[model samples]
Target: MRTLTSSTTRRRLAPLLVTFSACAVLSGAMTPAAFADDARSHEWYLDAMQADSMWKVSSGQGVTVAVVDSGVDPSAPELQGQLVPGEDLNDGKAGETEDRTGHGTEMAALIAGTGAGGGIQGLAPRAKILPLRYNVKAPSMDTAPRGIRYAVDHGARIINMSFGIELPGEIPGLREAIDYADRKGVLMFASSGNAGDKDNVITAPASMAGVVAVGAVDKSLTVTKWSNHGSELALAAPGDDIPMRCANGEGYCSSGGTSQATALASASAALVWSAHPGWTGNQVLRALIETAGRPTEGKVPSEYVGYGFVRPRMVLLEHQGDPGAANVYPLPNGPASASSSPAPSKAGQAVSSAPQHGEAEAAAGSGNTTLWVLLGLGAAVVVGGVAAFVVRRRSA
Candidate 1:
């Protein structure tokens, strides 16, 4: 998209009064609104994921993310109407909903931008983006598995996929459209590749196997030599140099990779699946990997950063968690089922005990650089030579 990012220390942004609703005001085709005053005052991970008490609870509304890539203009005024109509497995010539390369409109305005116009204010700020539009840059090999089966046949529960391929094999129609969007449950994130300090490559629908991958952290939780790590990652977000809105929202650019951390881990699973709308996408990925953000306690995960950086406010405001079962599969190794075989990983328990009810802006430990981050849903990376959807700039 457009990046240059920076972070060694010295940062602020957490005042957040946030009220919005004269139809979500503030836009003069934003970007550069005096640098920082509103429009999420340059989003420092939304006050380290408190975002005005998780938008009171969850502004993700009904939820409907399906941002394949290479398109999604949605008229840009912080994405008017938040958008709903999608499709363009790369056919409408090129303007598929229209976006060329603001990097899918900066991962769809960082997963539903609602800062109105100064831009960049989305961590599910009333989530709603469904612009499928493939043709990634060139190497389509079938418009990214027909835009992941047209975003799980039109409904789109969740499927971010910022973009990636690395080419080697496993393109069997994107592993049969990721086992048909995991038998239509959806959820699929991606990104887990920025090159992890160059050539630590792994890529594939984010190394396939149900897809979640992600990775990328900075601001101090470390792990950003270039993102991309192994054991198929599974967590981590915040891809440094943050700040977005380029692709025609006029100005404002300072993107990162892991494609804005897979659109903030798909807007933190559309705010814990819009506050548990009956929960299932394997219980909202087992309550965001059991309230993530671990560094140690017993069995943490890490090729770089996994199972530890996506705290959906400790499962939506200290209710803590346990969203297991529901066709189980909490991620741990992969590719091991030939038929209906999904019940084993009841997932972890000691999320260090999980209880931040006192929320002094949470994040009291575990690399507490404002509590790591989330949103690096794979894809959108290409070393060189590409074409049916070619790319290589998540802030290269």
Candidate 2:
């Protein structure tokens, strides 16, 4: 068996054991009292994304997002009554609510936390969380596939994978499981990786088709320097300078990375799905893509921010975005036919090089042109100009 290293920090593990490290990104400890006093203030993305306005329309009440990661602490104030019983693929003795690394808890909170007891408020406050635990330190190849299948079988509408493995190619059973989840109409989101400023190697499951590979953006709405970029990237969300529950459960901590971005994207999907319960996973994803914030200048699907930053507000509040054909997957590497099951292709590589029509038009100024056109109007003209400059600076 080949060994796998986490996309976050690279470390040696025992032979035959794969390491699926939690994409902790960047983290710093904070005391409980201090966190209670100032934690929510650090969540700048909530305000920037206009979460308050979106909440008035939908709180993701009926959606359940499965978090595949270290584990979640059900006892946390914000997570109370938010967790559905989940299975632990690791030892199975501790169950899924016990968090060893705290990363899972942070991701859970980011998706559905209720903001009680001064905790971090989730993007979809009323959504439920289903935690699926795997052995991060010494997992086998089957670990991720098992967790994914469990989430799909257990009524999880969306799956959030906040960890990644850097492999030269796809893992044996992982890709098939993702396709299975897709065929089942389950939407999956994974972190694009946090090594953007470094090696920036494409990390799997994220790069795999059928999974939405999410990158990171800061409070300025510009992609973060550490958020990995590639053809596989599908969307982006706020990740930098975010607040999260500390692993030790003492209080909160400031963290940043694509992992957080993935959580927010999942929550965004939950909100859209909750508002439109009859919408299929494909429709929900389509709405997100159609309403996403694209770069003012660049190819429609930029290697950095894929379709662009996720903006559920445009779909939820403004009633914008067209939910396209429910059965047809929207992305380039999506299933070939309308059957929902992915068309057969090479084992690991993505097949399609062309962008979707809507994506292309959106990029070419057919739709949403009024929203971002001002970005090209020069820095002194509009806020989007500043954003354009920042995006170019970081990507350069």
Candidate 3:
């Protein structure tokens, strides 16, 4: 029997990817990068992430990320040859080439948008993006499996899904598809949603084992109140007030979203993968997780930021991370090891004042991981297929 609950769809799917979707994520407006020339200074997070130094080691030249969101406009000046043919799960025009909602376009830019036409610069400028366009209105049964299968069947090394749904149903096919990708040595990332201050719940497919659940944080390294927190969280990245192209894929918006965070996380993986071409997805992911900036020591993951903020430069330059078992999963079956929490830092990230939703003190083995059950919705029970739930909703 399949489990039934919400939080199965991608994170930005309900809020940004789907047409006619409801979004309550507060729009903190910022100065949009009008052109690529006007925008280099606008992406302040890149410097915080030390993108330049990391680029000296690896530019992610040979990696391809399958962006499974809205359609993408591959012809965008910044994306010229960086995008390859993908699949269309929804409308036809955007089938792996053009983007409609612009959300997908921005995500593509974040992953590999070159600083061309005075547009936003990507974390991995040489990496390629594969578009996997799907409609929010499509039946869940048909959507999840097909999109995932197509991306894996193709040559996608990393899959980025910044959208999701919060329902009371578990599509086994979706789980199987994720398993297939992992088995094939693909690294998957999805937004943890922007709802941590309220009902900080675990969202899928991030909640699923083997997939990396990414949350949001500002350049200050402080975990934002909006990003959801749970044991599902694998790591955190810059999500608050980022600069990127608007949804139409034409203009720019300085205020980016959690979807951007997921994309950046994916790009980080690509950078590491490109630098170490011989490593498997498991090895690459282990490097990111183990080398991430964390205040707590040992194996325990933070509920809010997981292993803490992603520091690809640490992996590329310092070479401080370990590539554990090539095929073994990293998450602890029981409790992960722990240590005392470190104080907050002046730059970048530090330990938060309070523990993430279910984590414990920094002391050795002091944390507890919790998995919340999905309760029922009122009259409108999502029956046949699941739809992406808005991030602003009370429960997801």
Question: Can you write out model 1's per-residue Cα lDDT over 63-118, one digit (the tens) per residue?
Answer: 89988887788776788889888877756676558766557767887888887766
Error of 1 at 31 (Å): 17
Error of 1 at 367 (Å): 42
Q: How accurate is candidate 1 locally (lDDT)?
A: 0.64
User: How much is 201 displaced in model 2, in angstroms?
Assistant: 1.4
lDDT of each: 0.64, 0.72, 0.64
User: In candidate 2, what residue range of length 10 has the lowest lDDT sum?
Assistant: 373-382
Say which prediction, candidate 1 or candidate 2, comes out ahead on TM-score: 2
Order of candidate numbers by TM-score, starting with the best: 2, 3, 1
Model 1 off-target regions past 4 Å? Answer: 1-41, 50-66, 69-92, 95-103, 108-131, 134-185, 188-250, 253-267, 270-280, 286-320, 326-357, 360-396
What lDDT score goes with residue 111 in model 3?
Answer: 85
Summarize candidate 3's per-residue lDDT along 1-396 as a digit string, tens digits: 222121111212112322211122433322222223244655766776668878999989899999887777866788888888888876455466655456777788888989898777899999988888776545356566678788889899999988766646546778788778877888888888766766666666777776788877553334555778777787877776566555444344445446778999999999999999998887788788766655433334656667666777778877857876666655542111111122112113333334221222232223343211111111112323321111221233
RMSD of 3: 11.8
